[model samples]
Target: MDLSCFKAYDLRGRVPDQLNPVLAEKIGRAYVEITGAKKVIVGYDIRLSSPDIAEALSSGLMAAGADVFDIGLCGTEQVYFATSHYKMDGGIMVTASHNPKDHNGMKMVGPESRPISSDNGLNEIRDRVLEPFGDAPQQGRYEPLEVMSAYVDHLLGYIDAGSLSPLTIVCNAGNGGAGLVIDELEQHLPFEFVKVHHQPDGHFPNGVPNPILPENRAATADAVIAEGAAMGIAWDGDYDRCFFFDENGRFIEGYYIVGLLADQFLRKTGGGKVIHDPRLTWNTMDLVKAAGGEAIESKTGHAFIKQRMRDEDAVYGGEMSAHHYFRDFAYCDSGMIPWLLVAERLCQSGQTLSSLIDARIEAYPASGEINRTIDDPPKVIAAIEAKYSVGAKSVSHVDGVSIEFDDWRFNLRMSNTEPVVRLNVESRADIPLMEEKTEELLAEMQRLNEER
Candidate 1:
């Protein structure tokens, strides 16, 4: 019931303090009241605290006159899939998602896996959770279902693996729930993949499973080189965002992967629309356009991108944050799809990960995304816009501040869930220039913030 758990995008905080059984019960009641949903699906990750939280949450949902369908031991994406697949009125995922073990949270989706963040009802949920109601509501029944096998089969339905050739790859599940899926899927897969941290260890003794952190990426890169594998892939705690390592043990940027996945999906869909975040490379734009598809840009967040995808009827969407969504998957983001497509691409083209990326590296040089902590985000953004906004070029205030030039572009924006400013810069095949411009803009951002 604590207000601190009401985040910008989702409800998240420490287990006992900000999130607990009492709080979950209130949110469940509030969710049903808000959505008028009669049936709700729920799932959790491999964290030790997840099961308890799920049970508490289920109690709350049932108390609110909602039937709770518990999909035992699954990832966040699985909840999204179940919400759409089972025609449930809504779904909730009890996962902190790459956070440390002490943390726990809930991600809710409306019917069709539509997100419910602060703008959509998180604030109202928080208010209702804190408000003292006289008595607990009537309880409904509970049912258990096994949706993992069916979800996997549904994913594999989109692409054929029979045409794939043999290749050695390394996979690191980072001791999250993804280990369970990898263990099952790898058994029938045709590729030679060396699995690491394939067991579900809630402690995550090695490290948090986030692939964005440079420290976390090292293990996957090292495993790829040590095993002499063609490529490496790692998943976050809930397996929603996938990160990749090349054959030479080099970590690839998520921006590039966006373009790669956009290309792959467009290939099969035959020129359908593709959606991408504004922060990343124009390479995705070019790739989508070149494939005879329309490219749409949206703010950098799963909720926003998914909504945009559904509105545009886009076939696929990818964000620099590593979340990829498919129209077939109810426009919800998945950490599982990127790696599967990467594996298929490797097999079909008979090329290494580096080679596949290398072919496009020349056309899409990038400085990688950078983050800066600041107090006055608006002033900093306004200063950058005043200085950088040119007459002929385009400038947009979609999510944050985005400016497009003839040969280069950059997006400087504040994080939706954090207090930091994020800057993503990319240029036309010029790494040095990209780095220089990135530094220049970052310096200006800092200077303006300091002045204010």
Candidate 2:
């Protein structure tokens, strides 16, 4: 068995080559050994390879003397919800998220929906896969279950529209698993919305259905504008993250959405605490602090943010990547929550999405996260630190490397799963300085790449 399936956040790779039935079986045995659990709930997305991978994973789990409750055809979060909702001993979701259709991945959740990344038990699983393990455990069995409806119901529990007013929204499912959730939710929720490419086409005919790309957003934005919808919401393959389009079909950056969600949660929870990734906004921190809540900044990535939330007991957490976590939802990010909150806010205020975000952009202008190809990310980071460390109020190596000045700051870091350096620069109304500093950083990264 090969170990290439092990990735930064989850077990992911191209199907049948890097990730095959044999490797998945070994992973199941290893996961059971690591967790010492007897019962596991398994789920999968609507990918062409998902069902086969799900079967292989179940075989491994059952081989390890674990009873596998196979919850067919679901998203990663549904598995998370199942782990706690049904009191399952553990769970696994087979998905590659927004990756190409050829790619597939697995995300695991321990009891109570605790995530297990490579740092936790994925490495051990990888090791076991490399060296095929001991005899299969005894009494392993398989059971089938359907939890999609239950999962949708659980999501709706957080958003009740009894006294809510309605408006038009354009929902773009991107031909991913989100279509199922949106389809069900629309049946119960009274809202006039246009849906584009809501079918679950495993091939992802329209270019992987990822909302992050301008090309992928075109259909959704066009639908929103053509239908005269209030706003547009587009989700990634698994619906783990969501992006928005304003009434004018302009794509609203995720950073502002994070701040908006933070504001909403802070208002409701009376401002306990909110956490955000450093990649995008200090405006989130400002909003959290302004709401009389404490703001905690953590590194990018869902695992890092979730861990920080657990440590801080934060009421909410968000990232510029569009992942929004909630305290009520076990501190895990949900693509579903943001839309509900947005709808509720719109109903309550009778304001459009653009109107709500106008003041936020003015207050905390951002450069948006920029990525550059680099050979030696560490060397580039060192060079940037050496050049800009002067008069730096403070420095943190938390995620990548972040340096702060009195009025502005920047975070330059390498991608954990790729060969590139990510740069995010923000300032106190100094767009020119931000651009200049960004240029300096990009030049350094290019210089380092050439040197390498």
Largest lDDT belongs to which candidate?
1
Estimate candidate 2's alpha-carbon lDDT, on a 0 to 1 scale: 0.84
Residue-wise C-alpha lDDT for candidate 2, range 290-403, written one tens digit per residue: 888998888888888888899999989998888999877777878988998888778778888999987787776777889888767788789888888888998888788889
| Pairs of residues clashing in candidate 2 | 95-105
289-350 per-residue lDDT for model 1 (tens digits):
88888999888888888888888999999987888999999998887877888888877777
How many pairs of residues collide in model 2?
Answer: 1
**Cα lDDT computed for each candidate against the true fold:** 0.85, 0.84
Candidate 1 segments exceeding 4 Å error:
134-138
* Candidate 2: stretches off by over 4 Å: 132-137
TM-score of 2: 0.95
